[model samples]
Target: MSDLPSPHDWVKRSAQSLKVERLEAFFSGHAFDAHKHDTYAIGRTLSGVQRFRYRGVSKNSLPGETMILHPDVEHDGHAGSASGFRYQMLYISPALVQQVLHGKPLPFFKDGVSHDPRLSAATAALLNSMEDELDPLEEDDSLYGLVTTLQAVCGYNQAHGTTHDYAAAALAREYIDDCIEQAITLDDLAKCAGRDRWSLSKDFRAYFGTSPHRYMTMRRLDRVKAAVFAGRTLVDASVEAGFFDQSHMTRHFKKAFGISPSRWCLSLGE
Candidate 1:
């Protein structure tokens, strides 16, 4: 941990995408305002004791342990020791977790940092090299593993009441694949699956790690990639995958993939 200024104003910045952020402060005497995020804060503390008030319970995370904060949960963070805290965080979306869980309802972890070693290894693998370029196959595999472990380790124990609901999330996954090429709206999808858009969206993100729209973007990217490999132009491939144009595809392509689509396509030639 870097030496924290004795009396500090805490500031954290997103390193690359909103899906993750890096904290580089020792908020020894400072307190974070209570706020909620749209994504899960799944991460590990690098050093010092990271203290936070979560779901009305106080939990302290230290080195070698993982913390999984559910989305929209009220929480606050500060140092739990004199040396302060440094941690790497991945703001996972519910859809991402759901994808790994094989469309199970987003699992609920205990309201604190965890000592589970499986949690550490699984979450670490994806968020560790946030900036490294990933092959498509690697991205899918890693995300699948991460999501599944998170659900298994962190899932709500009282699933008896909502077992049917969880089943719906599973059915939603099958629904999505069949309708991938269609111009499907949230309302349309919810109606088709007998789910509310909000729940469906949450389930989708928890399982897939991206919004339904972005998931579609990725699916389209996959199709575009195959087309490019078969000697199609970017414009044609984009159109074939239901993208507006090459530029529309490019923006999402880079954000979802961490690289330009052209680069990925060129690599096929190589």
Candidate 2:
């Protein structure tokens, strides 16, 4: 097990892709303001009670229960008990889930917390401990199993909707990867993919789990994280990563990731 940070500490690990962000944290009380991300916040409470508001309902996650917060929903976090709560979490992108489900609407959990044994076991391996180094194959395999388990548990039957243009959306995603530092507009992506802007926008979100702008921002954020890891100052990194300024980068960084840049650096021993 990785050494726990001091009380009220929040520490995150390193992941090369924005598709995944893993962390182990302890919160004495209110940990974050109401915020939403473009990825599912899936985690397990290890000790004490994890309390949060989801879908306008108050929910409590005790140790051994899995908490699944769907993408793009407002939620808040706090420790439910005086002793505080310790937990491990993985922020998984909807695109990753779409890779498995392939055009299905993202699964929804009516309740934010679950005690299902299968779902619990599936996440146990991935969220086993904060320090476990995941090799490429192991990580991919675990992600595959995890998403399938979620689908089964949530009864996601892949309802039929307007068929999405995955190929076009994929082209836009590739273009974003190629021109990460440049300003990219929906029209730009639409031109590249040979699709209508509004149609492409809906297809992109359905296929990739976020809008074109958000996908670009996350890719840029990935670069920012890499730059910061390479000893570049935050200001330099922000500019190099294509943000307007440090504050611009900081705002999206916290919104996408739940932690500030400096704290992320400190947790990484920078």
Whose TM-score is greatest here?
2
Which segments of model 1 are wrong by more than 4 Å?
A: 1-28, 130-136, 155-270
Tens-digit per-residue lDDT, 69-125, candidate 2: 887777888888898988888888877887888767678887989999888988876
TM-score of 2: 0.87
Q: After superposition, how far is residue 67 of candidate 2 from its true place, in Å?
A: 1.3
Compose the digit string of candidate 1's lDDT tens values, residues 1-270: 122223443434333332334333345543454555545778888778888888998889888998888765668777788777877776565655554555455677766688888888877776565546545576567667766776677655643544335555556656666777678788876776788989878666655444666656666776787688688999999988888889998876655533466555543432
- The local distance difference test score of model 1 is 0.65
**Candidate achieving the largest lDDT:** 2
Evaluate residue 128 in candidate 1 and report its C-alpha lDDT on the 0 to 100 scale. 68
Q: Residue 155 in candidate 1 has what lDDT?
A: 56
